[model samples]
Target chain A: DAGITQSPRHKVTETGTPVTLRCHQTENHRYMYWYRQDPGHGLRLIHYSYGVKDTDKGEVSDGYSVSRSKTEDFLLTLESATSSQTSVYFCAIREAGAYEQYFGPGTRLTVT
Target chain B: AQTVTQSQPEMSVQEAETVTLSCTYDTSESDYYLFWYKQPPSRQMILVIRQEAYKQQNATENRFSVNFQKAAKSFSLKISDSQLGDAAMYFCAYRSYTNAGKSTFGDGTTLTVKP
Candidate 1:
């Protein structure tokens, strides 16, 4: 389980509304990432944070924003939710001495 | 950019038997890392196994092992003594040794464990 948790496991909201998803990790890993999972796309990274306040855009960063103000808590926000953004979101953490990444349970979001 | 390919979209394996999932990758770097990730219905992504390009010996984790063919740019996962719990969506991933944050993943192979 990796002691990782994602808030609002499931959410259904109308378009043009704002949404935010939170990911909390007890492991205090150095790296955190936000990804979206779709039918044929598998998992695509949206954004990643190497350290607090230091983030970078991933392959699919449009329409999504992330913030890591402190360790253990990473937040993903959608300024204006759209139907195309409806998908499962996953958060992952990479530890210092390990090549593997631990993922959170995931948050399923649906935009109407 | 690194890319991983999982040729098998779906595979079925009998319980207590063995199955192999094929994975091929494209990368210009000589040193990199290959990984196999399993995502069960629960939606948690777990690392099944990992192989380092610099190491000639393949990496093995209990019932899961990888065959790393550096020359062929292929890294396949072989499951021995398959169990019902092994049924999941398997994803092949690639990461450059120099960078740990970026990872490229395959579409995924759904493995069904036949009883």
Candidate 2:
């Protein structure tokens, strides 16, 4: 509903293989974030971007990396996928001076 | 880092009735934001309501309202006229205005609406 789109809605990859999930926003929001949702743990931040070429690590950024080369695109990559990395990844965006964030449909990733 | 807590792991409510979900947070900062996100079977994280720390008045969105006790660091969500579709996992989240946009979320409370 926030003009946010996440690519590869579902993904399956082998362990040790690299996987990348893409989050694109059409609204050109100033901030974008990636989060992973698990069973007991609600949602943990992975990485975020405040602007083009500006990125920062989140709480659960150990196994993930993010890039924001453009204003409308943010990419999250896992260099070596693992079973523990399987999760439902979400992309969220917040407008300037806004206190709330809008989330996109999530992507379910499985690492076998 | 700010932390959000939802002690109720699960709760049940009758259809057309009302239910309240409790959420507490810890933060040293004076200004921040609290949010309630609903995740249904579709797995989409929907923003149900939010409250600004600086504002004394609570925030409401249609049937969803928040009882924000700034002094107690408590933010509870009240759902009126609960429908079957309201059965979902409700998460409490906190974000610091001075920090990065990263939000800390509670484990979540699974709400079940009984007909």
Candidate 3:
């Protein structure tokens, strides 16, 4: 929970349209991550940010782009949505020098 | 690259009984961390327990305890006197000290507690 919120808790978008999910945190943690949960794949990291304007790709970052312009907000964008992109997205954060990462409620994204 | 493996896809235990969930990991780094996370129907990832590679002592949180074998690369979670609320999808995770924020997680084990 950790004072983390993801916008558009349930989203339905058409294929080929652009979609963006937002993660906002109030704890001012140093690390933020975006992950997608699938049936068989478990949870796969899509992107993460260490600081403002500093972002990096994760294992499944092929179709996802991320930006962290501010400390509290991190955005994940899909250039063109696809059926494969439909899944539950989770946002996680960790404080400086901490080992445990806390997660948000999650956003369910669907593309038809 | 590190990988976590949860061999048991699902487990069940009777109320007031005990159940152990198995977890094995492959890692080349000597200094890292291991964790157990539980996600119930709400899908909220909750931290169950954590084990550091350097610590030889096993960690215990009330009824939740961990059996950590550093040499065997095995970490198992044991829940004593199980309750219905303890039933959830448990995931084993690994985080290297070098890559602090990035965690590698296992497929997961769905636990069911019978009344």
Candidate 4:
């Protein structure tokens, strides 16, 4: 198991509310990624951070934002939650020059 | 752009039998990586095996092995002596060597191992 952890393992929020999920890692890996898993779509990348204050959009970046101020913490925020955003979010970290990514326990979010 | 496809939505195998999961990908990049990840009922993602495009030989981890045909754009996972613990959703993913380690994943195949 990797030293990765996702906070708020399960959450439910009403539409149009603000919600943020946190991913913390102890490995100090340079790359951190956020993905959302949905039926028939598998896991889609939401966003990724290569280093502190450096981030990039993924295939499904809409309706989500991410920030990394430190090496160990990466945060994903849904500015205004929507029903479409209801899914399982996962956080993964990859060390530099590593081919495999270590995943954290997923966070399940529900938007009513 | 890259896309991963897992044609089988579900499969079942008797315990101690061997089963293979199919995966095909489309990529223009010559050098990349392919991976198989297993997500049990607990929903924790575990890396089953990985194959580097540059490597001609397939990669194996214990009972899990991959058949990598780079020219065919095919990567399949073979589980030998399957156990009930192998029952889970298996995902095939593709990552380019140039990208920042971002991956494109297939819809996934659910494996059912009957004891």
Candidate 5:
């Protein structure tokens, strides 16, 4: 698809349950990022990966963990989902050190 | 660390007219990049325009152009002959050199096209 795909486009989960969102990219880009969009706050970076096994946290990384085991896949895990975690999650990919990015369609997660 | 700021929370423009969305950023590095992304109702983020800090010339894509004022640390998007399809949320973003490149996004401006 020459694009990024986010799995489970829409999800409904109960609080205290673990949820994982997967981001797969056919572009094989070295830089991958996860961001959450909330009302008023816009998009805030949760985590990002520069390469396989090279990941770092962004401004709002609490309660979220990410792993980049391969260049094509970046996984975001919510150890225990909460109502406040309900938001649209976006996955983005770009070449190393490039500003231009291609984003996935986004995943809408709801915690009840 | 770099920060991107989009001042206009919402804006309205008539079809076939022009509208400008304002943005400003803060960074200490000399080399960086700025970008604008559009998110439609589908929630798909698409790249609108991009500019490299080293380049003095503004980057333009069709009717979409950026007013890059490096001295003022300002980057504004101007859409000319706006179309109904242009109605969406426009996000201004900034990326700077760190151990790895990390992008910071603005609050975004919702542009409404009134026909």
Candidate 6:
């Protein structure tokens, strides 16, 4: 409910194909993050952006790349999709001084 | 680095009964934040409660409350008068006071409320 939306709520791609997921926020928050949720593993951060064109890697950033050219949109790309990359991806936004993050609906990706 | 752990993978409780979910974290920092998030079958994540390590008193929201033991490094969530709607996956998370908006989350505990 924080004015966040993830494009392509669902996606299917073959292995070795390129895939990109989009996260758009209307709240104009300064911080945006990409996370993947898996069974028994919980949610793990993939990448995050603090401001326009400013980004950082997370604990599970391998095989994944992100770009934040604008303040409203942050993109997560997988150079080459793999079966291991299939999972529910969530996007979250937070204000500069806020302690909590608001999440989007999430995107389900499948690699065949 | 901070890590969160939820010892219980599953739990059950009858309607109107009280249930407590366990959570523990490893952190050396003196100040930080802890949170409980609920994810229903709809897959929407909702914030249930939050506690600031600097506060001695526990944080409560309606029928939900937290028992935070700083010295023991334990944070547990107590749900009172549990309802069927409370049946869902609960996650405990820890955030550093100085870290940029990043949080470490526990695996999760599935709570089943029997009517």
Chain A TM-score values, per prediction: 0.97, 0.97, 0.97, 0.98, 0.96, 0.98
Q: Write the per-residue lDDT of candidate 6 for residues B6-37, one digit (tens) a residue.
A: 99999999999999999999999998999999
In the range B1-115, model 2's lDDT, one tens digit per residue, is 7888999999999999999999999998998889999999998888898888899999999999999999899999999999999999999999888666578999999999999
DockQ of each: 0.67, 0.85, 0.70, 0.89, 0.77, 0.78
Give the chain B TM-score for each candidate. Answer: 0.97, 0.97, 0.98, 0.99, 0.97, 0.98
- Return whichever of 4 and 6 wins on lDDT: 4
lDDT of 2 by residue, A3-80 (tens): 999999999999999999999999989999999999888899989899999998888899898899999999999999
Best model per DockQ: 4
Error of 4 at B26 (Å): 0.4
Candidate 5 per-residue lDDT, tens place, A26-79, comes to 887999999999977568999999899999999999999999898999999999
For A1-112, candidate 4 gives per-residue lDDT tens digits of 7899999999999999999999999998999999999976679999999999999999999999999999999999999999999999999999989998999999999999
Worst 10 residues of 3 chain A by lDDT: A39-48
DockQ preference between candidates 1 and 4, better one = 4
Chain B TM-score for candidate 6: 0.98
Tens digits of lDDT, candidate 6, A41-110: 6789999999999999998999999999999999999999999999999999999988899999999999
iRMSD for each candidate structure, in the order shown: 1.2, 0.9, 1.2, 0.8, 1.2, 0.8
Clashing pairs in 1: none
Q: Is candidate 2 or candidate 4 better by DockQ?
A: 4
Q: lDDT per residue, candidate 3, A31-91, as tens digits?
A: 9999999985568899999999988888899999999999999999999999999999999
State the C-alpha RMSD over the true interface residues for candidate 3, after superposing those residues.
1.2
Off by over 4 Å in 2: none
Q: Estimate the TM-score of every prediction.
A: 0.96, 0.97, 0.98, 0.99, 0.96, 0.99
Q: Report the Cα lDDT for residue B104, model 2.
A: 93
Q: Is model 6 an incorrect, acceptable, medium or high docking prediction?
A: medium
Docking class of 2: high
True contacts kept of each: 0.48, 0.94, 0.52, 0.94, 0.77, 0.58
* Positional deviation of residue A21's Cα in model 1 after best superposition, in angstroms: 0.8
lDDT of 5 at A2: 48
Extract clashing residue pairs from model 5. Answer: none
